[model samples]
Target: MSDDQLFALANALPLVGWLALCLAPLARPALVASARVVAAAMAVGYAVMVGLALARAGGPAPDLTTLSGLARAFSDPHVMLVGWVHYLALDLWTGAWEAEDAGRRGVPHWLLLPCLALTFLAGPIGLLLFLGVRTLPGRRVPARP
Candidate 1:
């Protein structure tokens, strides 16, 4: 795919995922499942694109006008930010999934909410926040054998 097409697709992912999630309440279980699968696939594709950008490293990048030229785009802030947003969206979606999973597992919902918000705003910050929240001030207990 061309650069423009790739960028457009990358940009569309979060919107598409959000739309599906938003519509899920009225959809059948199978429909919701299909939405989730599409969201997950989009997230994975976003990640692979990120890896490709890192590999390119700010050199003469792809033209995006041609399928073969898509990987040729240089590593620039614009591209990086687009990739970052994709990462954030994926990260948030994963957090949402985890929150649902945690509910199924009987973990508290409160624990997941803040992390989700943090990641939604900025991907790395959510992880940092989670780690910060997880670290207790109390003394560490000895490991049980």
Candidate 2:
């Protein structure tokens, strides 16, 4: 497939997982299952894509050590796709964790949807938001071992 097509696939994969996760409060099992499956896919996909990016005819790999270096890295299409997928994988993972934690705490579905959205938009930011919510005074239920 073309690089652009592959990039679309990479983007779509996480959205599928994220959508399942958004329904976690109603179906914790689904979220848990998708979390595991998506995590596996992300890992394998990243490894494969990294290999491709390294082999592709393009500029050097992203220099994450500095802001300018990082920008230069994303100038390549393959590298950009890898970076996007990286975000998608981590964001989904974060959202899955939030769903599990929220489930344990008995947080309402109403609240979790937005948190999931935020997580999808910005991985750590959403996690921080949920952490704040998780810490607020409320009835906390013990999680199943």
For all predicted structures, in order, the TM-scores are 0.43, 0.86
lDDT of each: 0.56, 0.79
Pairs of residues at least 3 apart in sequence or in different chains that clash in candidate 1: 2-64, 3-64, 58-75, 61-72, 61-73, 61-74, 62-72, 62-73
Write model 1 residue lDDT over 39-121, tens digit each, in one string: 67766776777787668666554587975555444255557555665674566465445444433343334665576567656
Task: Report the lDDT tens digits of candidate 2 across residue range 41-135.
Answer: 98688888888767874765457899898888788777788887778777788788888878888787778877888888877778888888887
Model 2: residues with Cα > 4 Å off, grouped in runs: 56-62, 143-145
Best by lDDT: 2
Report the error of model 2 at residue 28, Å.
0.4
Cα RMSDs, all models: 9.1, 2.2
Least accurate 10 contiguous residues by lDDT in model 1: 100-109
* Global fold similarity of model 1 (TM-score): 0.43
